[model samples]
Target chain A: MKYKAKVFVTLRPSVLDPAGTAVQSALTQMSYNVESVRIGKYVEMVLDATDESEASDRLHQACDQLLANPVIENYRFELVEAL
Target chain B: MKYKAKVFVTLRPSVLDPAGTAVQSALTQMSYNVESVRIGKYVEMVLDATDESEASDRLHQACDQLLANPVIENYRFELVEAL
Candidate 1:
């Protein structure tokens, strides 16, 4: 079976996100009533696997190995069986 | 009321994502059996609003004006009431 994963990589709450701060300031200049902004990554990947467990393992491995920096970022995923 | 919005900005189906391609190739080299990869942005914003409708409107405007390029990307958001 093929599984599709939607992975989200976000900076930890304790980590400082300069990019997000910059964007927030820019948005403020534009008069948007936003108090804070943070940016993260969303990744979609398709993997060939035998079942949900296998796909889940692979997705977690991918996130740990390549998709996120564990020291400062947190990653989560949603997996769905795909046709 | 305080609102938190999680916004997703993604490339349209027709747009090429070169960065995702590079990562896919790298993962393949590391022995991941992946078929496709696409990457996008996840934005978290905190807004001050009286209700959900106002928060939703402000979030959409922010996305359309600065967070996403409508010609080549699509954006969606989920808003939650926050303390």
Candidate 2:
């Protein structure tokens, strides 16, 4: 079976996010009334697995090992069976 | 009311994504059996608006003008009431 995962990797809340801050200020200056903005990486990947549980395990491993930097960033993912 | 929005901006399917290709290859090399990988930007924003409709409108405008490049990228967002 093939599984598709959508992974969202974001900076830890305590960490400084200059890019997010810049976007927030830009939106405010544009009169958008935006209070805050936090930007992160969204990754979509397709992988092979024997079953849903195995797929989930692989996705988590991939995120932890390669996709996210655990020290400064937090990560989460949703997995679904691919057609 | 304050509204929170999670926006995802991705490259069009027809567009070539070298970074994605690199990631896919790297994952496969790591014995992940990954077929494809695509990366994009995920942004979370908090904004003030009178109502849901108004908040939605503002978010759409923000995405169009700043959050995404419509020519080569596609964007979608989910809006929810902020506490």
Candidate 3:
């Protein structure tokens, strides 16, 4: 069997998000009444793991090596049946 | 004074994600050896809520009315200090 996971990786609490800041500023300037802005990365992956544990492990590897920057961003995810 | 929320809205258990399917097909064709494919939406919003409770309420409203297709996707979120 196969599984799918959606991984969300975001800037840690202490990091400054300049892109989000700039976007928020633009939105506010446009009269959107925005207060603050945050920018994060989104990734969806389909893996070869057959069960939930293996899927989680492979997903973690993907996140650790290529999907996210552990130095500055915190990551979370959800795993579910692909179909 | 301000708050930041990251909203992730994904296809519900039964909805098919064609875009994600196409992307996964491409990956497999490229020798990525992928299994199944699923796709979801990611949104980041900066709101004017003064406290956590209000922020949650505003975020929920945003997700309900504008951020997600409630009929097909389930939404999840996290809130944190912007800076």
Candidate 4:
């Protein structure tokens, strides 16, 4: 079976995010009344698996092992069967 | 009312993404069998709005005016009422 995973990688709340701050500043300069801006990584991938459960497990493993840095980053993913 | 917006910004298919390429190579090195990997930006923000439709409009405007470069990047967003 084929599955698609949408992974979101974000910095831990306690960590400083310079990129986010820069973006916020830019938005403010552009006259957008936004309170805050956060920048993170979104990854989409298709993978082979035996079943939905197996695909979920593999996606979690991928996020933990490669997609996100455990110390400073956190990740969440959603998986769906792909055509 | 308060609303939350999840924005995804990705390079157009025709554009070159070196960062995506580097991550794809890293994933391959880690022994993950993946067809391809695409990396993009994810942004989350909370804003004040009169209703869902207004929130959606503001999110779209934000993306078009600042969050994404329409020439090379494309964006999509989802909005939900915040508790």
lDDT of 2 by residue, B1-53 (tens): 99999999999999999989999998988999899999999999999999999
Model 2 lDDT tens row, A1-83 = 98889999999999999999999999988999998899999999889999999998888888889999999999999999999
Give candidate 2's error at residue B59 in angstroms. 0.6
Over the full model, what C-alpha lDDT does candidate 2 score relative to the true structure?
A: 0.94
Indicate which candidate wins on TM-score: 2
Interface DockQ of candidate 3: 0.29
> Over the stretch B16-67, how does candidate 4's per-residue lDDT look in tens digits?
8888788778877877666667889999887777888887887888899888
Ranked candidates, highest DockQ first:
2, 1, 4, 3
What is the lDDT, from 0 to 100, of the residue B22 in candidate 4?
83
Query: How well is each residue in A1-83 modelled by candidate 3, as lDDT tens digits?
Result: 56777777788879998877876676566545566566675667767765788878767766676556889988899888777
Assess the local accuracy of residue B3 in candidate 4 as a C-alpha lDDT between 0 and 100: 85
Please say which candidate is ahead in lDDT: 2 or 3: 2
Q: List the candidate 1 regions with Cα displacement exceeding 4 Å.
A: none
Please give, for residues B1-83, the per-residue lDDT of candidate 3 as tens digits: 67777777778869987876776676666544467665665667767756888878767765676556889988899888666
**lDDT of all predictions:** 0.93, 0.94, 0.72, 0.85
Interface RMSD of each: 0.8, 0.6, 3.6, 1.3
lDDT of 4 at A72: 97
Reference-based TM-score of each model: 0.97, 0.98, 0.60, 0.91
Error of 2 at B64 (Å): 0.6
TM-score of 3: 0.60
Q: Is candidate 1 or candidate 4 better by TM-score?
A: 1
As a TM-score, model 4 comes out at: 0.91
Model 1: pairs clashing at backbone N, Cα or C within 3 Å: none
